[model samples]
Every structure is written in structure tokens, then in C-alpha cells.
Target: MTGRPNDWLLRQLPYGMLSEDFFVRFVSIFQEQAGTLLQHADNLPYLADVDVTPPAMVRHMGEWLGMPGIDTSYPAATQRRILRTAAQTLQWRGTVRGLTHLLELYSGGPVHVTESGGVYREGAAPDDPAWAVLEVDSTGPLSESDFLALVLDEVPAHVQVEVRVAGRTVWPVLAEEGEMAS
Candidate 1:
């Protein structure tokens, strides 16, 4: 019969030598333990199919699935948030909102996106090149190169992207005065 190892072991036992009460008790205990194991096995597929939105499952199974936004480099809470929102953000892919969200996620700050040529003015042609400018105001610890890489990874190939860092001070215009005051 198709059954667990415990069932086969019980079948091979010398049942004739055992008292009826002893045999019944032993079989009952074996079934109880084996049934629990079988139930867990049955749930394995459901667990595997669970989405990454659950923080516990993301922490446990993320590496096996290579899930996005579950990087260990980020803080635990950030990783959980990223996993929770990954699917939602992916739905907006190729849009300005998506890029802005991605930049915010990677930089841990606010992002502003400005687009050009995508909208049709009254008489404008539809073929105009679309471009976007991303302004990031971040005081987080991400380096410039890492921030750029993260932004670039999310941007669509068809859209040109310009990145500008906010709050930087530009050099003051020179005057005939010997020194410039801040």
C-alpha cells in the first residue's frame, strides 16, 4: 500500500506476538505522528506559492526565490517594505510614477520627476522624443554612483533621464570686490 515508512514498519512487525491492546495503542500513536508530518508536507506547496508581501516568508524564502527588494544590505524594515510593495511598483513600470517610486526606495528619500514631449499639445506630433528629469533630494547614506545605478536600472530605454541632486550650492558669481560673502 502507498503509505509512510512508519506504516511499512508496523506491517513488518510480529503482530501475532503482541496483545491486541498493545498493537492497537502502538498503531494509534504511529498514525498520530505520521499524520502530522503528512499534513505539513501537504502545506509545502502553499507556502512556496506565497507572495513576498509577508515579511516572515520573505525573510525565510527570499533567497531561494531571488526576490526583488529583499536585499540584505538594506535595513530589515526597509527590506520588508520593499518586498511588500514590489509587485505594486512593478505594475506601474515604464511610467513616471514607477521611476519616482524606485528612486525613493533606493535612496530612502523623496523624488520628483518631470517629463517632456510625452504629452500632445494641440498641434504637436505624436512622435516627439520623450525625456524625463529626476530630481532627488536625499540625505541618506547612498553614494552618488550607487544612487545613479539604482535610478538607471528602473528607467525605461525609450526615455532619456537626467539626474539632478537637490540642495547643492552653486558657486557665487564673481564681482569686482576682493572677496565674495556667503
Candidate 2:
């Protein structure tokens, strides 16, 4: 996991742009982890192949990178491990309260962090699976560009929102999800 593109970075290309530092370092990490994933994939072989989903690959890389608690028995635990590793490396935690605050603005929804550190919108309970199962560690390390894409994808449009960062607030052009959901 030291010198190669891990599976997560490869999958994220379809999602949005990445900064040069992020892109380069992540690719290096990904490349370093690919061989380990291949070996481990042959061992337990969760997916049909090593390079399927971004999140899955990240988990695989975490296993090789020695990320703690990454091999949790629960699905949510596994997600959490991947997220935490990515967040720490990317320096995303500073934005947690900010992201939560932004969610409140957009949805007019209350926001709070779960005991495990995942964020939830107003009306979401601590036990809610969205918060419980999401494994929010990576949200901590996200770059401004990546964070914006996350907000656009993660936030529901029916709720009003205004995301603020670095003292600037932004009202995003919400996407249509109703038809898509149906």
C-alpha cells in the first residue's frame, strides 16, 4: 500500500475531480495496495474482482495498510474503517461541524453527530441506518471539490440548505431526485 493506486482512487474517477496532491498521493497508495488486494482477494475473495467498487477497494487497501478495526464483523464497521483512514489522510475532520451546519441550512433540518461520529440530518435518530451504516470517516479528509460533490449527492433537495465553509455560504443548485427515486 505504499507505492501504488489503491482500488478506491480508481473507482472515484467517475465521481468528480481530485486535486493534484490528492490525486497523486491517492494513486500512489492505490498502486501500493493493489498487489495486496489481489493476494487477499485470492484468500477470501469478497468481490468477483479486486477493482469493482471504490469503497470496497478502499477497505481492501486498509487491510493491507494496517488501518485499525478495518476488519470488523459488521458491514458498518468495515465502512467506518475505510472512511476514518481516508479522512485522516485527507484531513477532513476539520469540516465535520461545518458539513453538519451546512446540512442544516439546506434541509432546514437539525444536525447532530452520532456517538460513533457519523452525522445525521434533523429527525434522524442515533440508531438510524443512514448514520449507523454509512461509515463516515472519509468525509473528514475530503477536499473542497470532493466535499461539494458529496453535498450535492448526499443532501436531499426537498429540504432547504445553505452550506458554509471558510466563512462563505453557498446555496447549491439542487438536482432532481424524485423521478429518479421513483
Best by TM-score: 1
Model 1 / residue 33 / CA error / Å: 12
Model 1 misplaced stretches (Cα beyond 4 Å): 1-69, 117-128, 139-141, 167-182
Tens-digit lDDT track for model 1 on 60-169?
65454334335566666776666555555777777888777767776677888788845566777566577777777772557776666666667777776667777542
**lDDT tens digits, residue span 1-182, model 2:** 23434455555564454546687676768666776666665546554233344455656665554433233333654455444544444333224454555343323335443323445698674653332111122334345455556565444443333444543433343458623221
What TM-score would every model get versus the actual structure?
Answer: 0.55, 0.27
* Candidate 1 lowest-lDDT run of ten: 167-176
lDDT of 2: 0.46
Candidate 1's displacement at residue 149, Å, is 1.4
For model 1, what is the C-alpha lDDT against the true structure?
0.63
lDDT of each: 0.63, 0.46
lDDT of 2 at 32: 67
